[model samples]
Target: MAVELDPQLMDILACPSDDHAPLRAGTPTDPDADVLTCTSCGRGFPVVDGIPVLLLDEAIPPADSASTSRAGD
Candidate 1:
């Protein structure tokens, strides 16, 4: 089953980072997965068992330049 979040809660969700910018819902890799992305810092937070893991330690940083950049694209 797809992990669903309440629209009302999503509206108030913000990044726990220093910037504390609003978070955007991300496309989950798995049906049971849910993710929230910080627009300002480019950090991603995972949601487990339908609960968003907003902890800073659990946040994933944006992809490195080496991994995101291609030789020619």
Candidate 2:
């Protein structure tokens, strides 16, 4: 059986670098299809090996390299 994720832990988990918006966990359709979407930025953060990859590049990188990347900025 899969371990039940701690609600409080999930509750406290915002976009890795973004604290302004909260994350709402979703049910993965496929075992490998894991993702957490940011409501504010409309970016999908992926979860791999039971870990959520919350970096912007992890979801979608800046249009250009010059953009000093920050989460949901």
Candidate 3:
């Protein structure tokens, strides 16, 4: 099911990363993923039971971030 977060809350929600970018509902990869994706870093923070888990440890980093880090090695 699609998560329905308040528009006002969404507007205030920011990614808990160094970028601290604005977050939007769901992700670019999956619109119904029940998570909020960062506009800058593209990390996806899962929403559990209507509560947003914004911790960096809980965030699913963008696929490219993984590959890019590996490529640098």
Best model per TM-score: 3
RMSD of every candidate to native, in Å, equals 4.5, 7.7, 1.8
TM-score of each: 0.72, 0.57, 0.85
Tens digits of per-residue lDDT, candidate 3, 1-73, equal 6668999999999998887899988788778889999999999999999999999999998978878899989
Model 3 TM-score relative to the real fold? 0.85
Q: For model 1, what is the C-alpha lDDT against the true structure?
A: 0.75
Ranking by TM-score: 3, 1, 2
Instruction: Report the lDDT tens digits of candidate 1 across residue range 1-73.
Output: 4447899998899999888898777733333436787878777788888798999999876655335665456
* Per-residue accuracy of model 2 over 1-41 as CA lDDT, tens digit each: 23235777778778665555776554233223366655565
The reply for model 2, stretches above 4 Å from the true place, is 1-4, 17-19, 27-33, 60-73
Query: What residue pairs clash in candidate 1, if any at all?
Result: none
Weakest ten-residue segment in model 2 by summed lDDT: 24-33
**Residue 14 displacement (Å), model 1:** 0.3
C-alpha positional error of residue 71 in candidate 2 after TM-score superposition, expressed in Å: 24
